[model samples]
Target chain A: AQTVTQSQPEMSVQEAETVTLSCTYDTSESDYYLFWYKQPPSRQMILVIRQEAYKQQNATENRFSVNFQKAAKSFSLKISDSQLGDAAMYFCAYPSITQGGSEKLVFGKGTKLTVNP
Target chain B: GAGVSQSPSNKVTEKGKDVELRCDPISGHTALYWYRQSLGQGLEFLIYFQGNSAPDKSGLPSDRFSAERTGGSVSTLTIQRTQQEDSAVYLCASSLGVLGEETQYFGPGTRLLVL
Candidate 1:
């Protein structure tokens, strides 16, 4: 079974600083995709960034970036120059293929981020 | 273009009553999915529809939970005999259904509270 794990239940960072949310996963499939989603108080799941397993280059989207280590099976999210708006729940997800051949996102418990000014 | 949208942004119901949640995916999206977020379970996939056919109902918690998508655009999830444990934020998402391009756009979600 493929499983995603976010060990940190909560994390805090000072505004304008950098914070890295940890995520690890175990999957037997050689080809897959990993994603980081942000859920604010509005309850909307917004896609922050995504990384393909086949790619060696890390994915970066403006202030958001990922440190993906395929051999270690670790994928962590880094928020640079974090702002008050960056405070939200961060979830690491792995799209795993089921036995029936459909894909479903397996998500971690999530890390609640607090950006303190 | 509008993103995925869900009706009844918030619903309050008593236990044992049936509730229906609706989702309107992005126009032209062939794949739709339903997910649940609760305090205990965090987030879980309930079901997904590929152009009105659901090949993956494996994530549904029980028989009480069911979903259907018609015309490849609108989808509805019905929970029979709601339980307090069923209280959670239900989210809907849509994708192009193209292989290797799995980015999904999500709705704001419907917060369901069962009393």
Candidate 2:
């Protein structure tokens, strides 16, 4: 099976500063994709960034980026120029194919991000 | 374009009663998924549907939990004899269901509170 792990339960960053949340995953598939999702107090989950395992370049989206280390099985998200609105629960996920041939996302426990003014 | 939508933004129910959560996926998307998020268990997949057919229901926690998608667009998740542990935010997502187009767009989840 596949599993995602976020070692840090919480992280804080000053506004305009940068913060990085750690994520590690285990999967036997050689080709896959990684995603970061943000869930705020409103309970709406928004896609933050995505990284393709086949690509050597790290994925970035405006202020959000990822440091994906394929060898170490690590995919960490970096939030630069952090703003108060960036405060949310961030989850790292990857797709896994079930025995019945359907794909499902396996998610990490999540890291709560707090942006301090 | 409208994103994935879920009905009943919040629900409160008794322990033994049943509850139904609804989801409307993005238009033309062939794959829909159900997931649950709770304090105890971060996030878990519940089921996956492709074009109104469920190829995988393995993520369902128990027999009491069941889901179905119809018209290949809307889906409903039903919990029979709801329990306290079933209290969580139920999320729905949809994608094109084709390889290399697997980015799933999520909806604002339905928060289900079981008393």
Candidate 3:
């Protein structure tokens, strides 16, 4: 079984500033996928960014980027130019690729990020 | 035209009563999933469905919690003899395929409360 850990239970970032949410995982599989999702007060789970384990280059989407250290089993999400809309519960998920087309996502406890003005 | 959708934005039922939650996945999507989120439990995967294959109900907490996908399009999760512990936000998601490697699109979720 795969386990994802988000050490920071809560984080606060000044609007327009940068913030980093920490995440670590335990897995023996060489190939897998990592993702960051945001759940706002609206309770909508929004996909933020993703990183493929086999790829050395980290993944970035607009203002969001990941620092993926495969050996360390660390995949941290960095949010730059943060906005008020970014205030929400952020979760780190791990989904492994298997033989078939089926995949199940495992999520961490999540960190509540607050964008302070 | 796109994105997963769930019904009964909110539901309240008495303890011991049965309740049903619905999910409508994106058209042509071959994968659908069910998850529950509560204050005590962050996010838990309950089941996964693909095409006409049998669903992976391994995540279901108990026999009272069961889900079925009809025609591989829509799905319904029924809770028999609901309990207060079952109160939580039930979320539905879908993806292009059933592969665990694919990105999943989530619905807003249905908040269920057992009184």
Q: What order do candidates take by TM-score, descending?
A: 1, 2, 3
Regions more than 4 Å wrong, model 3: A96-102, B98-101
lDDT of 2 by residue, B1-115 (tens): 9999999999999999999999999999998889999874567888888885644888889999999887777999999999999999999988997533577888999999999
- What total of clashing residue pairs does each candidate reach? 0, 0, 4
The CA lDDT at A105 in model 1 is: 83
Q: Which 10-residue window of candidate 1 chain A scores lowest in summed lDDT?
A: A96-105
**Model 2, stretches more than 4 Å misplaced?**
none
Q: Model 2's A-chain: what TM-score? A: 0.97
lDDT tens string, model 3, A1-117?
678999999999999999999999999999888889999977778889988899999999999999999999999999999999899999999884332434678889999999998
lDDT of 3 by residue, B16-89 (tens): 99999999998989889898999834678888888998887778899999999988899999999999999999
True contacts kept of 2: 0.57
* Consecutive 10-residue window with the lowest summed lDDT within model 3 chain B: B94-103
- i-RMS values of the candidates, in order? 2.0, 1.9, 3.6
Docking quality level of the chain pair in candidate 1: medium
- Say what the RMSD of model 2 is: 1.3
How high is the lDDT of residue A11 in model 3? 96
Best by TM-score: 1
Task: Kindly indicate the candidate among 2 and 3 with the higher DockQ.
Answer: 2
Q: What is the lDDT of residue B41 in candidate 3?
A: 49
Sort by lDDT, best first: what order?
Answer: 1, 2, 3
